[model samples]
Target: MDDCTDRATKRSFLAGLGSLGFIAFGTAAGRTSAATDSQNTDPQPGKGPFTDSDEPEAFVDDVMAERIGTTTPGATVAIVSGDTPSLTKGYGAADVDADVPVRADETVFRGGSVGKLVTFTAVMQGVEQGVLDLDTDVNSYLGDSTVTVPDTYDDPVTLRHLGTHTAGFESTLDPDIVADPAALDSLEALLTNQQPSRIRPPGELVGYSNYGAGLAGHVIAEAHDTTFEEYVQSEIFEPLGMTRSTFAQPVPDDQPGNLAAPHVRDGESFLVADDVYINMRPAGSLSATATDMAAFMSAHLGGGAVGDTRILDAETAETIHSRHHVRHPAVTNWRYGFHEYGNPDANLLGHSGATVKFTSYLLLALDHDIGIFVAYNGNPSEGPKAVVDEIVAEFDLQQAPTTPTPTWRSGGQERAETVAGEYSLTHLPQSGPLQVVDLLEHLTVEPADNGRLRTTILEGDGRQWVETVRVRGGGRARCPGLRGYRWRGGRAEYE
Candidate 1:
């Protein structure tokens, strides 16, 4: 584990998040304490979780149409298994102001962080072509002249490190991300101009780094001598026939009316998110139809090919799916661009993404031969809680262990003050001078009884204390009282 010499820094950061009216955690709490505490009633545990025994008829549809719609204005879902897609459906209004309903086949929504999966797929394909090496120092490619990583030591960041999120880059969140299309910067220029700090030694810790993914995209662009979007379009999307999918900003000229407008809930209206351009298109902002995403899911599961259009060699595909670095052995690990969470063998792989208004989730249950994609055009606290996790539970992908309160001798927190500190998400970018958010986002830990520690999170209105019921290894705190978010090395490792 890394040194805990920065405990006061950690506490100040988390305490800051709690002080910010607890806005982040409030975004995902969902329903009430009574509802979340209910036992699992899925009889098959294999077929579905929200079955008739647990809820009303057409439980999945009910959630998409009613529960999710209560917050998000529009959403689309696609479920594919084996050779065919079992479901491709949409719910609620695409444009509440225009009275247009969402359609799974026609409307497109931002895929958010799921786009990283597509980006890494291309990176792996390039590796197969012998154009790049996963273990080579990435700076050697981007060049010490253009982008320099200070204090890299013996082991510099590599493509594999970037894919597994162990590259040790601190987060960088540019508040001006939401800008006009013309105002956005090129991937290379952005990487060179606003390079992130290497907070940890390479391959030392698994902190989700979007900056690393974006940097990888830039490296790919440099190698191909083309824009990141163009490389992905010509190599991956076109081959898979994801015609409506795009990484380009400004929605492109050809796909104007097709892309769904961003929206958020108002009392009775859906507020249209302003036409703000996203700068980190490589990190997120991939727009595609649910039907198109299914094709992607199909290709990855089909040994990196859809029909005969081979995207990556079968061997390369196998390599990407294999575990590269495992943070937890029994639980799961990171496989190239993907990380395992819910499955036992860690066969299932995917990502979840979000912006101010848009949220998306993608899961590939390879063993089950099923791929699921869900995206909503509005920001809702329960967007993922009710949509993704519930659905994953239904498929019974893997038997993930839950941290229940142990009755044994029990571990206690003797080094509470030592462990108490703030952790900023490695996935997000840490603004250089704009320290407000970084301060507010800090997660503070304090000692508590029963081996528990009081932690603060940003959610809903503001900051509040969330006590952890159990403390795990590597200075990690498991809040069984909450959603079982495990924090180690001053960062949230997994949920």
Candidate 2:
């Protein structure tokens, strides 16, 4: 309900773009809980709160209602319990100037980086058909294409690396956004011209890369000898019967769904604004309704199948959900295209997304067979992820009771001192004008009392960490307030 930033006219589009990069990295799925018993337990038909219930829908309704006009001009939400679509609803005004209300099945909202899931799903499809291999060098697929990965290191960039965000593409923080739709170029041209240098070896570290995702889509298209949009439309969306989803810019007016008008906050109200086109379409240019997204989630929860149609085999879907990259043993890691939601052990997977004026988030509780998707027409500090966090907590999805047990391990203070320093996220830009954002995102670690460590960001949001054990590179620590919230010592290194 609080204003995220100044409502100045100057802070409308570009200001939101500045935070888009960070929003992609936001983990609003659940609290870091150390509870082990229920984290891995699968939900039975009548054994849990989420499956076959109206409680989750009611909770989501309340959450969306509170955030509708204040946090975002309009929002749509979808929840899938087991194999059934439990809830699909909309809130607030879709086009404020026209006084149009959102309709979950008819109103389309830009999905931003959340579309990376669809792109990666296509990659998994290629893998299933034996047209592509995860570990195979990506250059092999671009045999006649204009884009090619430069051999910057001994290792070749592979589809696995791209899906896991370990392809090592240099960070630019911008997804080739253009004001005019006419300025958008072909996927191959965009990839070739804006190719980022590989700064790290493939599969080395988990640095988020929009280029990596875009290139994955291009590879899929080339392998199928078709365009990205066409392939997904015919292969993924069509098979799943998702008619309201498309990766096309401007969302073709003839399409059945009504595209939600973008909005900018203006002194407790919102004004309609123009939408920008993402040149790297596969990475962030999906426009879908909540109803269509429900089908997408149902397919994933059903192990790549929905009813009689199966886009991916059960084995392929399992592989996509399996861990593809590990940031640390204690913290969240990357699944094929999705990332670990809360506790790595919790088995929750999700992704957050943002465009200049829209924000969205998706989470799948594999253990509970529940999928939650939310999208907003306006990008605020508290966006769709905030709604996701509330739903996650209300349902006790990935969280556990916090009961602190102090450790008496030797050299605790010394280990804490070793991690004490100022650091920045690897995903943030290290070069270009966007590098300025890295300055503000620095996480400062300082040794606290009783061998605990304190982490404070430039925004002064401080979290306490208690050391549990020494790991390979450094030590592992968890927060006592929320048990099981652990992270590797060098989560952020000195900049």
lDDT of each: 0.64, 0.75
- Tell me the TM-score of each prediction against the true structure: 0.76, 0.86
Worst 10 residues of 2 by lDDT: 30-39
Best by lDDT: 2
Clashes of 1: 32
Cα error, candidate 1, residue 35 (Å):
27
Q: Give per-residue CA lDDT, model 1, range 1-495, as digits (tens).
A: 111111232323322221111112212112111011112222342353223333421446656545544556677787766435656767666666676777777788877677888889989988999989999988777653376666656678899998988887765533225556778877666677777777667776665666778888888887788878999999988888788889888788887336777775555556666755657677776899877888888887888877778898889989988989865443446788876645436478867766556777788888777777888776566554357667766556666554333333444555344455555544444555645655556555556665445656664222222332445666554332222233555554321
lDDT score for residue 226 of model 1: 84
Off by over 4 Å in 2: 1-47, 50-53, 401-406, 448-450, 458-464, 471-495
